[model samples]
Every structure is written in structure tokens, then in C-alpha cells.
Target: MSGPRMTVVFATRDRATLLPRVLDRFAELQSPPGGWSLVVVDNGSRDRTVEVLRSYTDRLPLTALSCPQPGKNRALNAALQHLQGDLAVFTDDDVLPEPDWLVRLRAAADSHPEADLFGGTVLPDWPQPKPDWLCERAVEFSVLYAQQRRPSGACGFADIFGPNMAVRSAIFAAGTRFAEHVGPDDTNPLYAMGSETELLRRLEGAGHRGWFEASACVRHIIRPEQMEERWILNRAFRYGVGEGRHYAGRRSVGLLVRRLVYGIAARGSALLPPSPRRLRIRYRDRWLAGVAAGRPAARASPPSG
Candidate 1:
């Protein structure tokens, strides 16, 4: 039997400086027997991202498209129509796949014909001289960076993280799409965080199974600015927002009280030594606060294709 034909999809915005390195890694990917193509959607980048993508046309089987919309999901939804192949692999622009990434995904799809979704390990590509705090909390904070390392086998949609995930193209062909209202929007700071999770869960609910391919790994680049305390805490809050939206019906008076108590305790813990416990509590508190906020009000509609 022939290997699965694949279409790798990712959206980007204002990451001109990072695109070249990412595309360089893509150029290094070992193509599967059925071959593969890339569809990169530029989501309203004002920087030199367009020019950078143009320069890579000769190096990779790349189809660069534009959404001009601010949200990551909006851009992704637009690219769905352009996909080619039996598998639709989704990842972020900042992620660097191992040379055998696509080959492994194709193999997994071939091996598990029953599964419709696939996820791989995502390790951090930390900056040199990594901060002590990050070192201590890397595993605890992995979700903030969309990183995961799970055993290869049957898995749930929650285990299939963004940054490194693939789904059968038939799903998209049937009109399933990333939620436009939730996910990263360049114009909105308080946007909900689970752009991919929402889609994965919806698919799973529809009876689609997922598989984790341990050998197919990718490295998510840890940017310098993300190392700061403020950024980390803010990310924690956003994560909670996503969780809150995911479990919107679970809120209650008891939960509200617990959140208030935790919020106060987290604030008091700040004066003590910066241990992982303190940071964890603080992160939990921020997440609780976000849960209280629930989903943000609906934003402007994404631009039509």
C-alpha cells in the first residue's frame, strides 16, 4: 500500500525573523512515499513575513496563502480549502520538526488506519543560559508552551496538543474547522487560548480516535521574552480562560469561594522564597481568575475568503 499523502498546515503573523529557520527545518523533512506539501497562511502580517515566505518557494513544496485576518484559527480555516492529501498535519510556525517527523506521522497513519487524529512529542528548544525558574518548572509549564511527551498508543483529544498534531483530511473536507472565536488574535490580548483543543475535542466527540506517535517529535522554540515572570503568569491566566470555556457549565458558588481563597493565598506567597509550590499556586490562582471571567465577549467577525 502507498504511504498517505499529507498536507502540512500552519498559520503565522509578524514572525518574519523566525520563519526562515522554521522553513529551513521544513525543507529538511524526509518526504513520505505519497509525498507532502505545505500550506502556510500569513494572518495579516505587517512585517517582512511575506517576503520571507516568497524566498522559500524554490526550496520546499510550499503554497503560501494570506488571510489578512488577525486570528490564528481564521487563517487556518481559510487554508482548509487548499489542503492536498489524505492527512492534514497542523503545527505552529515556531515549531521545528525532526527530520523524520512527516515520515513518522505517515507511518503512524498507515499503521493505525482506525485512528483519525495523531499527536507527537513536543520538547522545548530553550534559549542558552536557561533561567533557573524555567528549569525548575519546565514540565509543570509545558502546556503554556504547547509542549508534551506522551507514550505512543491510544490517546484522547486532550493529549493531542497543538504545535504537533495531525488529523485525517476527510474531517476537514467534511467542514470541521478551528473555532474562530477562540484562539490567538493579534488584535485581542484577552482571546481564549485553546484554538486547536476545541477542534480536537469536537472531533473526538464525533467518535474519531486519536493516536500518540512518540518517535515523531518537534521542538517548540522558547522565545526570550517568554522567560519573564509577567509573561508566564499571563499565560497561566489565558490557559485558565480556555479551560473555563471548555467547562463553562461547571462553575458554582463553592468554586467561586475557592478561587477567592486561592487568589489571596497566592498573593501572600509572593513574599516567600520563589519555590515551585509558590509559582504553582500563583498559576492556579490566575487560572481561577480567568475561569471566573469565562470567555471574552464576541469580537469582530473574521474576514471572508
Candidate 2:
């Protein structure tokens, strides 16, 4: 907290190929005064990831932790214990950042020392000739927060991608640990049904600050697998589950009604005569997923190695 301004914490399952590019981006940061570090949290990878990580030997500040468990929070917790930064910058293995990411994040944190949480824009990385599907996906992702002039939950949606978010070191140092039981675990919320959003909410409750910035941008890799219809439906449903979990104690008739309305509205949107033929099916599947209230947390882990 006294010397260096920030540290980079990269968590991955089996992203050996993508690690270097991400590291290289950070290495290119412009005129950074503070000593920043990168932590690679291996969440149970069997591939040549460890070997590939070894390739970064010259990037001496790098540290690696092997978390055999496949859950995101489990691996993140393991890596978090090993970190000692005033700021912990978290980005997914699949995403690549602009060189100034750290500078902007550090500046954002310094500008608002009181806020315990920090969030930034996560624009999608569409293929050079962006596909129609990717365009729809972009709208879906952005509409969730395009209205947020500041950090608050009143927008009927509150979310942040783990791939492009940062949190104060004290959030971890101050014993504000993430939920080990859920989140990044079996399609679960890490902090007992709270997503990163819920964690920020807690930070807010505890009088921690959260701010939004345009400068901290990362292009998330919307992989081919994620483009599948079933995949997005699953994502939409899990979103409901996470949101439902976070607002557990406060659920009321009004809230339930609002959700019901959402369900109907989504169904109506899917029914729109002009909606894309391919995406409508996707929307239909999503509505069904929402109606089903999402499947129970999957015991299955992402294919590793």
C-alpha cells in the first residue's frame, strides 16, 4: 500500500496460449512508477499451462499457484492469499487489455481512495467482420449497464465481468473474502450466492466506494463456444440465479412481479416479427431457461488441460 500502487492478478483454468499476450500487454504499460505484479491462478489445469507459464521466466515478477479445484473463486482465493498489492487487478485469461490498463485502474483507485470497489467497461472483441450474432450479444451485454451514470443497483441490473474488473487490496486484506461456497463454483456465486456485483454491494454496505471509468477497457473473447444458442440461454438463466441469490433477503411481491414482467417482456421480444431468425431461437431458449429458473449448479467443470 505504501510503495507500489497496484498488482495484476490473472486467474485461468487452461489458457497457456493466451497468457503471454495478456502479459505482454501489461508489460507495455507506459511510464508506470509503481511496482506491479501478475499472479497466475491455475484453477486445475492439466495442459502444458504450467510449462508455458515457465516460459515467462524472464517476466520475473510472475507467480503461479495451482488450485486443483475447478471453481473460479476457489482458484482466485488461493491466488489472492499470495498477493500483496495495494490494488488487485483481475482480468480473465481470455481477455486482452490495452497497455494503459494498469495506469487507468491505478488512477481510478487513487482518485477515489474511499471506494473499496472499482469497475470498468468490458467491450466485446468481435471478429474483424463482426457477425450479426456478435452484434446482438454486444447489445445484450451493454444494455445491462449503459444507463449507469454511476455505481448503483437501481438500474434493475447490476453486474461486472470477472475478466475486466479490479478491487482494492484491502477488500481482500481487510478480510472481505469472496464466498468460497458459490460463484465461479459449479455455476454458483462465490460468496454464498453473490457474484462480483454482490461483493461490491457488500463493499458499499461496509462504506467502501465503487466507481466506473471509460479508460479501463478490455476486449472480452467471445469464443465460438460461447456463441452457441444453448450457451447464451444458459448464461441468461445463470444471470437470473445469481441476481436472485444476491437479493435473497429482500425479495418481495413487487420484485417477483417485476421478474415475471421481465420474463414476459423477453418472450415478447423474442416474438418480435423483425428479430433475427437465428437470434430469436436463442431468445426463446433464454426465455425458457428463465422460466425454468435455470438448472441447478453444474457439478461438471469446464474441460481442462
Best by TM-score: 1
TM-score between model 2 and native: 0.76
Clashes of each: 0, 11
Cα deviation at 154, candidate 1, in Å, is 0.6
- Tell me which residue pairs clash in candidate 1: none
Residues 1-305, model 2: lDDT tens digits? 34455777766767776667666765666534576777888787767788877777575477877888767777777887877668788777767677777777777777776565676667766445544654454336543222222342211114445666788787687677766655566444221233555566666677665666667777776666665555555555555455545544553455456556655665556545433554544444443334334334423222101
TM-score of 1: 0.93
In model 1, which range of ten residues has the least summed lDDT? 296-305
Cα RMSD, each candidate: 4.4, 5.8
Q: Residue 113 of candidate 1: its Cα lDDT?
A: 93
Q: What is the C-alpha lDDT profile of model 1 across 254-295, one tens digit per residue?
A: 767888898788879877876667777777777677776664
